[model samples]
Target: MDAREAYSIKVISEIRLERLGLLYGETRIKDNDYVTTVYLKDKPILEGKISLPKFIGDDLYYVKSEGSSALMRQSLYGEPQKVVELGKVLKYEPHGKGLLILGEDPLTKAEKDAPLVTSKRKYRFDGRGLLRTRTSLYLFDNKLRKVIEGDFDVTDFSTNGKRIVVSTSQPDDDVGLNALYELNLDNGEMKRITEKEGSIVALTMNENGEVAMLGHDRGKLPWAIREVILPEEGKRFVCGNTCGSTVLTDIFDGAKERLIFRGDEILTLGQIGGEVNIYRISDGKTEKLTHGQHVVRLFDYDGESLVYSLTRPDKPSLLVRKDEIYDPNPNFKGAIPEKVASSIEGWGIITGDNPTILFIHGGPHTAYGYSFFIEFQFFAQNGFNVIFANPSGSQGYGEDFARRCVGDWGGRDMQELLQFVQDVKKQYNLTKKIGVTGGSYGGFMTNWIVTQTDVFSAAISERSISNLVSMCGTSDIGFWFNAIESGIEDPWTVESMDKLMKMSPIYHVGKVKTPTMLIHGEEDYRCPIEQAEQFYVALRSRGVEAKLVRYQGDGHEHARKGRPENMIHRLSVKLEWFNAHLK
Candidate 1:
């Protein structure tokens, strides 16, 4: 299969409900062009380079990018009309007969002339770039009115006509914890509501002023499973001890529904092992509603019909409404990965042949499950067997397992990965030629593997971490992530520095003999492009086979949401390198 075949795939995401019926979004990639279409009741309603389409009453509201971003509204069978100009609209919700939007305000003349200055601990984010402008929630009634601005960022909010609950974090506070505030819709008065330490990613309210949220308290480490919490009642419900939302995926679907209220029952998506399904909680009892090996990316229920977007190992995303299936990419003929049995418990292998590629997921907390992975499918189509596993520090497993790699990044988890590879190679009678590749935490492991042993024939480290000491000050979340992940209160301390150095791959780069290829996004603040640069220089200085591929203007999410041409070029380059080294 040609790497260019990636253009043939289409993905459906953000299953929602409108006044008429089901509403969803579809994305299509063809050559260098990327197009998105909005569908209502299984029919195309609006099509453009727009995103985050929502139905407020009988009108469709969405964000469109034309040089900059503009909020556009279109009625049923009517033309799209521009509502307002916004700077990267993050979210918008219906408020009474108007709208409540959260986004960055346009730069004023004075602001644009002023130097970039900040007193905050963290000033940058991975995908959103810089925090130069403050995010604010605005009310768009007859005229635009500023409701409130975030000290850092306004993460999420929910309203019930009379009042609204907003979740935000201060600049100097811990990024893991967010404070919830309730604002009066009439008087504009606001008060903090949360009396506990937790982060609320999503929230919903009932007519009776009851609020339920999907978040975690970091009780199970930084990657704590998100559970449904009722702050007013001081009660919480676990979704099988798993996350109450979908985990990471390569496909660029917009945000998924985390928590919603179906009358008195609370509905959420639960991740367990290699599957994500729908779960309902009512009267202190939790029940799984849907069962399958596939991942339900997005869903909406209206007391009767249950509509959702699902993806399997062999399928791209398709919308399912009751018994009817709506596939956006019906003509996609790309290669699909076939699941194979693995000797290692909780590991997954997609069959192909010799010269296998062991792909590692990024989060170390995020898991690879029974879902469609375009990258894995691309490798399989190009004649390479793919193997992946959750290891110890992954979610969807129990809390203990999810936090196993905490304070032990390259210790037990690294050893287990090495053992799993050897065991799988022997079990499948694989060839000696094998490649190791990953991004973020997986990238850290790839760099570590090359340093620890020369078992791999080739290595591709993307947006990886090389030096923990440098990462403490460079990466976006490094200030706190380093301390939490390393179990060190202060990473700058001499003793903690020693521990961090021992876990850093760059410390042991002298032992690396495997031919390595470093890929990085120039704008990636999460791992920082300097990480790849340092490793590349180190390898080249030692006369080892090495190459560095930098993607200009792309960020940490380049692999999943970068421009179509760059994505295709990346795949082609990887295939070429693997073919030359392994084939």
Candidate 2:
């Protein structure tokens, strides 16, 4: 299957409601990727081609970002004219007869020399080296005159031509906090809106400027989908008991105003989970459009129809609609593994045999739900019962549970994972055939688990961090991620360094007896490949079986977006390791 990244989806021409524009990147090697735009109408038939980096459209014209620059076309089918020299436009929208672009400052010669700045402060993480870019909000006239410019990292924003609502985190704001502000385009006056705790992101406003925002309040667990009516009561929740974090992706206001969002539910508790869903909010009701274990990317609703791409455990993604579905990888047919969905505490069983594999998801903040996971399905289809859980520090639960492991990554989260393993073993009458594997923070946990106990027959840690002290200086965002996630004030201080070393997996590697496999991407800066190298060496020096597999020219997300052959090779390596040790 070809690896691809779908960028933007927009309804073109206010008069021609059915014409749609999509920008995406694809490659057979999944390397040397290039971006291209395709126009589609009522059916999913291609109308024309307009290649660009990023794009958006309105009635009379289409605005596109041409590699850190701007271009616009007045007609639906016409050559794009240079609009302005905007640098790396993250997002753009049609405002009145003008345009509002959220982008970074133009690159400078100094920045090009040494882009990344390492320090004890700064918590944000991006694939690109980080000095922390404050994505400014630019209001431009149709003639490309910049009217309004502001210094803030734009989280989300919406405008109705008269007023603009923006959610931003200023330079002085805390590591994870974002504040809401209303920007006046005419006079360029800015007024702070929400001053509450937690990050308020993803802004959506109707034609009348009725704003709805996604608020991840301090004490609230689920992301609060709230309606904001300023000057009196600031915000009120529409729904937050959905047991998952709701992210507002895109919203449109036509005759009927609508908002598009993504979230998940824990179908079968400790076992078969992960369902990333696309939702519609309108007229006092929340409607879930797609079901089953699937991942939806770049979904948009245009009043009468929905257009999106979906990926599942057994199937690659494709452009899909109500009347027709387009499969990009039609030849991607594998052994379809059986899936059983259950409650959070209950089990989602893909029945196979004893000695099942216990998989852990990354992002001590993210989760494992009833979604189609390729790795899990691969293990299950290969005669291994794969059990995973959304332990403490994961979203979907409430704030307390998610924040429980902040200062203690391996403490409660380890217990939750092991306890879930015990539950699965007892329920399924499993023996010593259990193996464990995870990447990133999950990789951190895998490293943590092997040091604490040798319950698993085999272990695989991918793109993991073993030493917090070393990771603080080496990782792309480790300077802050290590301490902030550990609930510390400063990572470089003696007290914090001592605690970090104690929490680091390398400190306890002497006790690890389980055969371990360290798989990493050579180019991973998030959890640099050196982290894996250190762990593999530690295990080998202790006379324990360990092997390191490094993927060249790959980054942190090798399994998800790396070359197709590399992804397959990763699965094969994990499979071979477990098959050798567990069997």
Candidate 3:
């Protein structure tokens, strides 16, 4: 398939089992505009520029953002009606007999007219952009009502109809650590449940009032493997060392149920040996329920049957239940990545000894596994062998492996990646010419790799970080992420600055000779576009071959969910650059 063909392939973003024994799935395709289609029983029921649809009772509820944000519902026999006007709904779900919404409150007249200023450390987030107001929980029974409004921001929440458990972050402490609180819907009273400083990624409550949380108590760094903790019982359930959550993937933004309660068991997704699968924990023993070489994106269980959306190396996303398969793009054909038997775990597609493009995944914590990547398939279809690996810093291994390259970004992990490239070349007897590309943390490694050695014929770094000092202040999570990742407690000190510089790729850019291209979005707050600008200027000043492509009105996820034209253009440019340099 060509780049445009790959872009046109429909991907199943989400799947859920309706109470009426009907399967609900959401799919997305991009051409002139991104279109989302909701399916019930494998038939299209709703199609438009809307998203996050769910069926509550007899009404189909969905969110529309064509012009303004609004929650609309359609009954079985009536047209769509506006339930309420949501200013900026972060998350909403069915709670008890009403709907619980977490969103930014509407701005007041005086506050909107006043100067925009905040003392909050995390004043901006990556996907949501700038944060001007604190988020509050609103309950809708007969009408929309603000139930829990506070000075803090809610991270994750769970409810049992009558009461709600919310994880909140205050202004003083680190934004990554949150405190749990229980809020009563009857009297609007709130009480702190946990006094420990930790991060709760997801949580759920059973009917017996037992709460299961997936988080760590800062024993290790932020990349610590999340455990299932019974907060009230003060007992941590040993599910496994690997985290039971989905790693970073570009295909979909579906619901990730990290921790959920079944009748007597706790079900969660766990990554092991580069594959994410479902696991069930009961009687203090963890059992792997599903097995295969595919990444499970989202899943739901209805007592007897389990329905999930999974993607393989050769296939896009599809729904699977018992013996039935609900593939959204059944006719779309593409290349498949074969497992590369090397000491370092990896996979690749060989195009008959063609010039290999070594791709690295972002999230020094996220591993590259049995997931379908459109970008890789596009490169392979264009006559290049695409190869990727899970180096030392990647997750899905043990906690020790995940934290190996925590403070040492370019140390062992970089060496292992270079070694893996050499092993692939030797195993396949390929040419010396090779191209390297990656985004975010992978981009940082690409920059670091070129500075260390010139083995690659070309390099493309997308949404990369070049300097740690500037990143600490510029990036949205930089203040805490950089400090914790680099093992520097006091980032503002002179000694810490020197240590961070030594680990940064920009400090060693003068030694780079590989032809490099930097791609970044103008609104990327995670890496910030300035990181690319600094590296581009450094390479140009040194008279090294370099190019920078900037996408307007896009963020760090430009390559994944940007405009269709921009996504295709980015792929074409990559192929053109690699062909000119390597082939």
TM-score list, all predictions: 0.95, 0.75, 0.94
lDDT for position 205 in model 2: 62
Flag the better candidate by TM-score, 1 or 2.
1
Q: After superposition, how far is residue 84 of candidate 1 from its true place, in Å?
A: 1.7
Give the 10-residue window scoring lowest on summed lDDT in candidate 1: 339-348
lDDT of 3 by residue, 133-188 (tens): 66778888879988877666777778766668887775233355777788888888
lDDT of 1 by residue, 309-427 (tens): 88877777878877888777777643444444443233434454567898877887888877777888888777787878777888887878888999998888878778878777766
Cα lDDT tens digits, model 2, 361-407, are 77767665533455655666567777777777766555566677888
Model 3 regions lying over 4 Å from their true place: 106-115, 171-174, 238-240, 253-255
TM-score for candidate 1: 0.95
Range of the 10 consecutive residues with the lowest summed lDDT in candidate 2: 247-256
Q: Give residue 113's lDDT in candidate 3 (0 to 100).
A: 70
What candidate 1 gets wrong by more than 4 Å, as runs, is: 31-33, 108-114, 171-176, 331-353
lDDT of 3: 0.80
